[model samples]
Target: MTTSATTETRTAAREEAEGHLRALVGSDDAVLRDDQWSAIEALAVDARRALVVQRTGWGKSAVYFVATLLLRSHGAGPTVIVSPLLALMRNQIAAAERAGIRAVTINSTNIEQWQPINDAINAGEVDVLLVSPERLNNPGFRDEVMPRLAATCGLLVVDEAHCISDWGHDFRPDYRRIRTLLDTLPTGIPVLATTATANARVTDDVAEQLGRDVLVLRGSLDRESLRLGVVRLKTAEMRLAWLADHLAEQPGSGIVYCLTVAATQEVAAYLRDRGHEVAAYSGQTDTTERQALEQALVDGRVKALIATSALGMGFDASLGFVINLGAPQSPVAYYQQVGRAGRGTDDATVVLLPQLEDRDIWAYFASLAFPPEQLVRQTLEVLGDAPGAMSTVALETYVELSRNRLETLLKVLDVDGAVRRVQGGWVATGQPWSYDAERYARVAEARQREQDAMLAYLDSTECRMRFLREQLDDPEAVDCGRCDNCGGLTLSTTVSDAAVAEAGEALSRPGVAIEPRKLWPTALANLGLDLKGKIATGPAAGRAIARLTDLGHGQALRALFRAGAEDGPVPDPLKSALLTVMKDWSRDWDERPVAIVGVESSTRPQLVGDLATGLSRVMQIPIVGRFAIVDPSIEPGRGAANSAQRVAAVQRRYDLMADVPAGPVLLVDDLVVSGWTLTVAGVALREAGASAVLPLTLGTQT
Candidate 1:
């Protein structure tokens, strides 16, 4: 055929595919909104592969659906969609079925499933065929399916295309070989890749790896309806209590993300005991059960779902909330999880409950980079023959690490191209043996550098939104105005003087003694044996009795210790310091206040419950006699005045806690950024009631 004739044929074929898409969707304009339509039109006009980078909930699927329909309508062969997850393929197939489109998927969930689908395509009956990337790299499947369908193949669509980029959060080694597939396809067959989230680096990587002339389309990342909040807890018990209370109040469709399968099971059980209709999904669960549970969630049989990171990638639900039970190791993960909630324009909540342990977990993983050559080599050798893929089972046979550790290591390898993924196994992409130690060392060093950068981003003290914007290379960035810190409602501040004075006055009552410990032995015991040991070793033996004499408690204890004093004199300074510390604490009640902000009103009860559970942590030993305060001033609203209200409200709440003798107050806020509101609230509490306040924010911004 002449060049012009071939061009005409290709144009005609694309137009036909567009028509088929409209017909399948049952409306000419069913798939694309105005902006989305513009994007599709641009893609169709340009024959090269293009990258569609949109925010979550922006209908990225519609772009490819429209393109497929256009091509199929023109008598093009079946459209092949390479997906990263079986759940995602099922989701798309389900949606297509609902729209009266003929779509089938080939994944492990269905045995011999692609056979019938392949037959249909050979007979020119199928319009769209969705398969996992692993399947695309399967020589047997490729040999059977591609040639039969090649004559009619219209467009190749790679969903969650970010997986093709090393910079992406969920990099898959198998995705790298997708470029080989593109190379094998007819030269004129255009490719289209779509992702909900990707930074500039990821976008570039996707284009490079796909080996296609690329066009880029990105939508706004801002989800104005989402209210972000962070909570910092001192212990695991406190985190559970927080989860229970938060789920209780929200009482809607949501997902609680845990870092491990064990954690997921534990949290789900805890929530269930608290009367939540909870479901759990983890890698440990059978695929069938997981599918049934996912369907139950979609059907509204479950009110809340607790899961590990395995659940979030391509799972879609219009949930009212998404709660992170622990801080994710990376912001990319954070954004992806939070994006699951607030799919609609209606206001929704994304709550992060960060504990010290969460940070430790991240730090631990960050420290695991730059593995020994043996470890890397073993990882590659295990991935042998697969060339770029490995099923969960296949991976287990090779790696000795726990599932979690192994997954992390595979993620690292996939990004580094030391190993690639294929159907049911991984393939060594670089030198399989230690043939080039120097080169391998250089590659390992580069990988470590990137990993370090990711860790630094996690540990940053800058605004989370600003940091993300910089990472994404978004030039027109502004303060998100919604995260814990940017909203100006942190609770980490000192209590006011007046509140502390009031607390002191209450404690100084004639009958009140400083040895409040004697008043509640059960409470003291519940403080844990660690505290008990600390007190016994440090102060309880010699100085505790004498210290009570300086405060009114000392006088009361002195009467009881008169015989001891007769036996042996106790030093005066230790006794005096105890009383002074108590008085100082009481005096600073208003000055140092703990502020707590709920991600949403629904989470207020959770904030309260977690605080109550963590009270011991705040009041024991190093933190004893400190104030425990909650500030509920930050609300989701626009404007500087609203921001000021958020700050003032936190201050006022701390001032209230400063007057209470619950212990030295710890400011509890959901999120922290610049620490300005926390500083203001601390100053206010000092001026109001607290002697001193320490700030405990859940997730630090940056």
Candidate 2:
């Protein structure tokens, strides 16, 4: 063919691609930026791996969607996107459909739809498929469906790719499964890794995983719309008061980020009490509720969604403001969350309210890091010598770790080839695996450094944006000339006395209901406990004077209950709080407790006795008697073990000491965790003919 004809054909193709991109964005005037085009060219034309690190609003989604359409036109197979969030998948699917590219997702919430989705993909009817990183570990998906998709995928895209790096603030173990996927991918298939927040270290880690000669496209990280500032509050109450006072003034709908799910609920309740339209979004939120909350934020129906990091990453709202109740431990996490705001506006407010507890929270999270070599080896030995594949639940019976911590360790082991997750459960891979002590130590060190950087950011007099950029290792870290420090703008730090008082009162108004354990824990039979199905007889729903993390009474309770805390009589103030709790409980009581029973404590016998005595005196109920230790040698503190072990331990430790009361009785304890203690005690009491057992405690450790 003539050179002129070939050139004309190529030019026409480019114009058509641009037109498709414009349609995808729903803007006739929409045009790709140079870097966006470069990413597209590298993915569709060059068929090479590429990483796009740009600000949130830089149209990263557009690049991938446009590339999907172009690749589909050339008859490349469906684009396989490993997205981190369900909200993001929904948004991407909607946007892809707008561009006439078919997209579907397979996630935990959409299990019933998986078969049809797989069928559609197999039939070449899907142009793009979005899957969560966790899905890569699913037995059926990994063993059956993923391989077929991987072999023919048009392009592989990792959204929020920073999560793949251990150095990332939001490192997810499931993301490591992507390395297996990458190793098995067909040659000549292009890959795209996109994120708005990855420092130089994370970038290097992710890029190395992508492949040799991967293209790295990083844009300036500055967001002119975000006006960054920090408001250091003296206490949680003051910080909450600040939010309640100033939330209404923020432009458009926004998010209020909290460090914990409990904190999210607390903040949301306080805000609602202060008359703000808000909802709490966190992992604990039901899937349907999460969808509703996401929609509420998008439609601007709510002022804000008080949330944990669960509400982050892939939530696409042109939020006008982002307020953090407590600072994230890492600057990258803070940057990613704040990036959610000001994406579609010229100006947006981003404020951080750093509290003293943020460091404690950070430390708590750090403690959940990769397990020690002993634990890792123990898990491996268990799997290696197992009779067969063991489900994570059953495996936990052999390991004395929380389900969360155990699952995390298992995922890490799965990546390291120490074990394999299959249809039945996990089996030892029989591959030699060495625990990387130095690597884990480095990760811990990196986390501490990030915490240090976050603290520095809170105290820095330099440009706030510049400080963040430097933390992310952005070369273009010049002062943004917009933050409070760079622009000489200081937000009002004063919180009203009335507001603080009200907040203090709200936080201190203790007594969160301790919902009774309705069912016996699963797999008790395996533990030789002879327990099966739900427990027919158990303690009635209970109440705690305060959670160990409560804002008001929580601090005192935590201090009193902390390890090494001296055992003593229940103090006068706590007695008053206990009285107040009962008073509150009386309002909703269906039956007056005729007696009080104390759970015997080996360490805090004095405290437990005092609390029970105090309640007995104030409520004028008979003292039924305290539970006696069946085995005095049995240690008092609950061990970190699975439910079966816990239940077995509780069963062997305590027994009813005296005749049961006929009427409802209040079963008092120093603290409640796992609910096994109360369960066994209540069962024994019921068997001994108590009408009902009402559990009340000074603190709960949920």
Candidate 3:
């Protein structure tokens, strides 16, 4: 056919395809808005393979579905679809079936049973045949079925086209050779590739790999209806507590992502205990069980799902919320998880709970990429040879890499097409074997550079939206004003010294009775400190004592007594006297009570006097002899609050003032980050003369 004739033929074919699409959708008189129809129109008219780089929830499937219908109506032989995931293929097939269009999928699950599909395609009875790269590369498939079908196929569709570019987040080595396979067809078929996420570099890579003039369709990346919240926690217990509270407030179909199988199970159990209808899925679960659980989630039988990264590839449910309890290893993974929710254009929420330890995980993954060049080259070489076939085991052995490492490398190579797996082994067909090794090296290097850039972006202090835009080469990116960073919302790090001092002075009043150090051992004897050797008085003993003191249990003796006092009958005379002092102090401080107290000197008597004065001023009545005096020269035990001399003074004075009635007490400290020293001081004062002890800080670490 002449070029003009071919153009005319293609144009007529596209118009028919479009008409079929309109009929299939039952919207013949329906006029789609410009923003929505412009992309579809472009894809229909573009001569070279076109890539629709739109965002999620933008009707990308419609663009290709229409194209397929139009081509079929115009007498085009058949359209073969290359899908990355089997679940997505099933979804598309189901949609087509519902629309009364004849569509079928050939993948691992049913490739052996695909004779009918093959026969139909060969007989020109099929409209679209969806197949995976691995299936297309199958020796049996390539040798027996593809050649027959190739004669009639007209349009080739590559979904999630980013999987074909090394720069794409989820590259598959097998996808690279797709272009070569299309080239081998009897007719040079027009190709259409579509992906939800791709930056400029990935788009370029896609165009170059497909070896076609590319028409690009860009869409807004913002999901304005979604509310994004980030929580930082120091412990898993805290994370659980926060999650429980969040779920209580917003109950719906949500996903809780955990880092490991164990974590998934544990989190699921925890949520179940809190009365949530929770389900858990991990690689450890049997395929049957996983599928059942996924169905339950989709059917809304389960309110929430706690799962590992394995749950998302094939699942499509419009979740109300997605919570990442842990940071994912890559941005691709992060985006994919987030994309799970808000799939149907409804408002959704994505909560990111970043553990304090997540930074280490990021560092570890980042460290794995330093030597990825050799791995990338080798992967490409392996994949190039096989074109589209490779068994997991065979590929693993050929690369001489671990299964996991091989999978990651293959994903990257899939984009670059250094090689692609067929079914049992890899094939290399796109780039020349002798093609500049330097250029391949550059591609690998470029990927590494991109990864590094992504990592940097995640760690950045700028707005996540703006950063992502810039990464996509949008120079005019503006602040999203939605993400946590852009909203200028962060926890306060400042604590006033005056507040601490006021709390201290209020607690150190006279006439207030507080527990004494001599009685502490008795009070806390139930804590099993004796068995743990936490009560020893040697050098190590002092450290232990200091540690306990910092934990806000007062001195070692005070901590033990507090622990034991509640457990047994304590009729000690000193306890009685302390109780009396406390009663009197409470009565005296009924009005205009002091809120804080601070020790100004290292002398035990001076500290006691300071406490007595504050107590007396707050209480108005004096219950003298309520404070205990300790030797200032003695070094403070280990874990004691702050300096040994200062703690010793506070401890001695606290023991002497044991008979004083306690009021609200704030322990004043020079440094407050960690609050360890203040905690110890508060514990000591509560046992001595204060009813409640709060921390007063002069300064805190930023």
Candidate 4:
């Protein structure tokens, strides 16, 4: 075709795209931007693969929604959108309705709707169908639903496309499944991938995976309406006090990001007590509650939602402010979160309240990177030797990694073709697999560099927006004259004495309940241990002074457990905190403990002994007996050890060397990590004539 003819054709497509945009946004005045039309033309006109790298609120969704309408109007099949989060799926479905598009979703939350939804798609009654990456690998979906959908898919949309690139901040294993499905797609079917957080490297990585001739439309990552600032507070108490004193003065309802779930609960509870209308959200929250909390924020019914990373991405709200209780590990991730605010509003506040302990949290997360090659081999060997497919619970008896980590590794291996996932569980394939140690090392080093960049962001004397954009490799990064460093306005650091006192009191209020284990880990007999089914002699629910990830006594507890720290008796603060736990705990207890028994600790013996002695003195209970280590070599100290391994490590390694009192035995230890050691010891004590066992510890891991 001639250039003139091609230009005429593109002009007509742009005019048609504008009409679709108006319907999508419910506005007669709405029109498509030049780049938005280009993306739509690539899919609707040329039928090509394209990766769009743009900032938040940049109409990335408009391109797809419009493209879907054009394709469906042209007698194409339904558009399949592989979304990553529930919040994103909900947001997409709502947008589809505005465009008069019939949208349906298949996710874990709405399992009952799957069959009906698939049936509607078959009847050509649905315009768009959304499914999460994790759902793509489901047996029913992968074998029955996904294949049929992919074969006739009109357009494939990968939302949050950065997830497929390991270089991206939020890379996920389940996303790798998309790469496999992409290879099987029918020719001439268009694919569109969109994200706001990918850097230059990540952009290239995703483009290469899409196809060789993929079109790349990249844009600036700078957010003009967001005024960025960093407020370096010395402690959690000071940060909380500052927020309490200044929350109402900030912009409209916003989100307060916390690094840990325990921090979210603590901060949300403290603010609520101070009369702030806030809610806590994390992965631990149920699906129903998460939806309600999200709606509350969107409707402006609450002041803010104290949340972890679970709410960091895909949430749509024109928030007035985005406050971080602590700094994120990387600047890329930080930008994605703060981008949620100031999208629709003309001006918004984005502040970071950094503390000294943030690096410790970063280190903790860094430790959960991909496991070593040796462990991967062991997992494969176990699957190979099994007579049938093995579930994650059964595999835990042979693998040392934690359940979450193990499951993620298995998914990655499945994608690598080293294992096959069937109806029941997983079976090893005879295919040879090689571990990419260099790739793992490179990713780790890249993460460290990202951490260093984030630290630079905290103390830099340049424009905050420019600093962030440059980190994302955005060429348009320049002095925006809109952040704290660019002479823009910022929130005050002044905290009142009363507010500080209130915050301090809240932090000092301690005690996290430790629920006892109800069922034994499956397949313990495979490891030479006689344990399975329900745990009949398990200890009753207990209380800890705090969680290691807490915002209160946790700081001190973390220091006490740090490497090379001195082994001493309980600190005055923790001891006093323990007294508070005792007072509050007694109100609900049926009877007080008659004796205290210390669980043998191979790492922190002195800490365990002192904890036991102090609790015994405070309760006026005698120190009747202690467990002795019979097999000193049976050390279960790896932070990565799973439940079954922990139980086996303590099964017969310790013996009750002391006579017990008649009543309940208060089991004391330095920490309760997996709670397996306490369970083993409590079972032994119960068999030795103790009526009941109550487990207590200084700190519990969440």
Candidate 5:
């Protein structure tokens, strides 16, 4: 790559890199492919930016690791790798060790190792250092650690580079921080960005962000080793039964991906009950627990790890299959998840069990898209006027965005130079920032197109793998002859009726605990509310008959909650389920409610009132009081949007509460979306001298 290098010099460097690659792969015959060597030369020798977009198993890691060693031998400093997943970091550390490269990672899981790792970086003893993109925004890292590293870094790598583009299926807000990182690195430092799932659009976006003269190397995105198929089922019970009856026949330990955390637990429990060894895993899984479960999958100690997207990206194992319990929201995401399998293997199965509720799940995620321009303007205005930096919680009181959405918005604003994150919290940079409504609308439209593509994948009769490749804009897309439609081997969907019945029982038997709010929301005084800090007395932890996301009862709940549904007494089946839930309540007789009360519902007053009446008649409890609307003009929809807004609406609505409930009370409501309504009502009841309040709701919207 160096114009002045002699032939001997280039050949020697090539040999050295190949030697390292052989050792990393544990095969003496393992040599770098031509494209891999090209990427390596562009970085290690030419000292230029390169973007590598290749299919999984194409040795992208080998390109960077080999380049790191080559650069080190030439007296360069350690390579800083911005990776996206903890599982990937773990796999990378082990892979680096095999290559005799001393790699260390700084992530959420290894907080205790940070000091030593930083020390090693200063000592020049570390060859490669791994970190998450989110870490780049951490005040300590951005202000203290990054400037030093950028000044000394030899090579910088951004793994899963597709995330840097909003067009990508996984366009994480944190990943946008990498653009700032690139701007800070020394001018001549070699930079490499890589991903296996990027389409032409994502590839161009990433390369443009990397800067001018970046060497773009995109190969065919096809995996011949993966045998893709779809198992269509009419109901959740049928799908669960299918998994129970056929999962044991899969070749080896693999992953079972679900869309939500609750579904992960339910499906995992059902499979375990059916005598398969499995574990439930999600982002909520503790750090230690995640490590153990990841190891179990790698070691084949468990048949499968039921998981959400948290377990995805860079988890390396000799996986023989990947089964999606339900379709992902997009084909690109589906390809990324299935890429976890069939690495270095001749054959691996990828199956999708498309659920009837997939579109509904897609709609739920769509609701969390970028907020309206008014909300964004509100957040910016709040930050601009604040005396000092405001924490995300404080911002939530001033703006209607939820915590997660607010945090994500802050990151985007930070990347756009409208705001900056400091040690304590966030401060506006006073830069004129224009809301790019057209850009956001384009992104939203892209996401919808991806969802439609996924739906097409589900119904396609051609090669399933080809459909995925086409979705990714792979020019080599063709029938692979290895899919179910192309005559690939597949499992049967003949589940026993008994298995279906068992799954039905598991799905329908529902009761999720509703943990009571302990402390009131912050900044209550700003809203002219007296509440602050911990409450002395409030509602006991309560229960819901079912979650609206429940696989068995969710469809029915959707029908009941859907706009324009008739409002009347609780349906007989739900009434029966409610009584059964009461019978199965964990509380003792002494903790039972002595009286019944109905919380006024503007949307479905009949549903809430009938619940209270039915409970009183069946249990013979006294009907003491009902909460009435004190301010009917209050916008109740705000109660479901943000904490401060919700508390205001709820407090205003329930100011006129009925008196004379002297004992534990059963407060009935149609649904609990945010719990602010229930919280305000319970606190008011306690202040009015009720002994205790317990909430019973028809559904939880989680």
Candidate 6:
């Protein structure tokens, strides 16, 4: 074909592509941005790699969707999209169908559908496949499906690609597996990485990982519709009051972001009590329930979904507002979340209720970073010596790390070529692995800097959007002319006294349940403990005065139980609160406890004894002697430790004293953490003639 003829054909193809994009968006006048077209051309015309670092709601999804269609038309295989959240995957599936493309997802929530989905993909029945980043490491998918997909996939897209960079605010270890995927892809296949939250460092890291000679398209990161403001609340109660008072008056239905699951539940319940239609969306929310809640928010059936970061990334609601109960640790994360608002609307309210406790929360999160080299080496040795692949549950028996931290470490090792993720679980590759202590330390320092930056964002008198954009390294950032600082702080910080009182009551009234352990730790025998299988009969489902993470009583309880705090007897206020708990608890008991038994505590003996003594006096129950520690030298250790070590530490350390009173007895302790102490103590009491054991504690740690 002549050059003029080829030019005419290319122009016609672009016009037709634009037509399909317009139809996909349901807008006759829809037009593609220049950068969007550039990304599309790179993926479709040249089959090259591209990274698009644009603001949220900037049609990043459109670029990939449009490219998928163009590639498929040219007889390309299905597009593979590795998304980070189930909510985002669901929205993408819906959007793909609207664009006359078939999209499916294989996620944790849909185990039963995997076989058929796999079959459909093999049969060329799926145009696009949306999967979680963790799916890349799943035994069946990684070993069986991924190899085929990598060979034949026409386009590979990584949404929320910032997660692939450890320097990013919300770094996820599973996303590191994407680099391996990219390595195995054929030379000519197109690859796309998209994120709205990447800074210069994260962008460089992700783009470098994408490949050589990659197209890096970055645009301004300012949100025109977001009106940012910070509401400085003196206490948690005031923050709750502010959200409850102003939620309805906001532009429309949106999210109320909480820092922790406990806070999410508390805020959601408080809003419900205040006659607002709301639901709690958190990591603990069931998959089906999360879907339902997401739909509720999308349909405007609920005014807000009180959520943790769990409700973030791909929870598409053209929300009118995004209210945060506490500031996030990183301005980048704050920008990503607030981007959820004002997507479809011309203007959306974005408010931050900054509390003094948010910094501590950030510290707690930072503490979960990559473990030290000793633990990593220990895990490697354990896996290296194992007879066969051990499941994560079984592997926990041989390691001292928590499940989450251990899993994260294993993923990092897998990416570093020190471990191989196999069908059953994991195996050490025996690779020469050197722990990058300097890199880990540098990442920790970066996180601290981000936390400091977040505090600055909260306190800055300059434009809030400008501050965020600058943090994201957006070069075109300027005064947005919309934020409270750029304009004026128009949001009222005043909260009604009645609302504050109600919030205070909700925060103060605490009866968080301390559910009993029904099963022994999976491999207690390996730990040299005789425990195995079901915990035949353990402490009855118990209640606490409050959770350590509770919004209302949590702060006080957390301070009271903080490390190095002087241990003392239960205070008068807590004693009175325990009485109220007992009274309310009595109303629901089928059989009232006739005796009280104390769990021996070396660290807080006086506190535990006084609490048991006070409960016995108020309930008119006799003291059924304390369970004494059999080995004073064996420390029970911190409650925050893993289940295996925790259970093993206290398994045989307690023995019920002789001549204990009979009948149902209340087991009193200063706190219930892993519940192993209660379990072992209850077993001793049962053997010593108590007919039943009822547990009561001052507080419960989640």
Quantify all predictions' global Cα lDDT against the true fold. 0.57, 0.85, 0.56, 0.89, 0.87, 0.86
lDDT of 6: 0.86
Runs of candidate 3 with Cα error greater than 4 angstroms are 1-30, 33-47, 186-188, 283-287, 313-315, 330-333, 359-400, 403-463, 474-476, 485-702
Q: Name model 6 segments beyond 4 Å from true.
A: 1-10, 638-640
List, residue by residue over 1-702, the lDDT tens digit for candidate 2: 112335565465567679888889888887777788878877877788999999888889988888888888888999999999988988888888988888999999889999999899889999999999999999888988999999999999999999999888889999998988999998888999999999888999999999856999998898889999988888878887898788888999999998888888888898899999999899999988898999989899999999988988988888999999888988888999999899889989999988766766677677788878887888899999989999887877667677888898999889888899987889999999988899989989998888888888988999999888888888988988888898745688888898899899888787888887777766767667787777788888888888775666877887898779998988777778888888888888778988888999988888988888878887787787777787877687544356766787787788889667777878889898777898888887777788888899998876
Q: Which portions of model 2 miss their true places by more than 4 Å?
A: 1-14, 630-634
Pick the lDDT winner. 4
For residue 561, what is the lDDT in candidate 1? 32
Q: What is the lDDT of residue 112 in candidate 6?
A: 100
Give each model a TM-score: 0.59, 0.95, 0.59, 0.98, 0.98, 0.97
lDDT of 1 by residue, 1-702 (tens): 122446676556456555655755567774345566555654444546777777788877767776666655555666788888777887888777755557888876776666777677778777788888766545667666665555457778888888876557676766776776776777667688888667787888787876746767766676665666666655455556666555655535778887656467656765676677998888888998988988887776888778887787788877788888777766666777888888754767777776444544554455544445675566677666444566544454344343445655665565455655455555567643343567546645644554455455545555555555555566666676766667632423233344344333323332211111111111222222111111221101011112221222333343433333332222343234334544444453444334322122223335334442343344442222222344445332211122222333433343333343332345444333334344544444445544444544322221
TM-score of 5: 0.98
Candidate 2 residue 450 Cα shift, in angstroms, is 1.4
- In model 5, how large is the Cα lDDT of residue 236? 93
**Superior candidate under TM-score, 2 versus 5:** 5
Query: Candidate order by TM-score, highest to lowest?
Result: 4, 5, 6, 2, 1, 3
lDDT of 5 at 205: 92
Instruction: Tell me the tens digit of each residue's lDDT in model 5 across 449-484.
Output: 989889988888888888888888888898899998
Model 2 Cα shift for residue 233 (angstroms): 2.6
> RMSD in Å for candidate 4, one decimal?
1.6
Q: What is every candidate's alpha-carbon RMSD to the true fold?
A: 19.5, 2.5, 18.9, 1.6, 1.5, 2.1
Error of 6 at 671 (Å): 1.6
Off by over 4 Å in 4: 1-8, 638-640
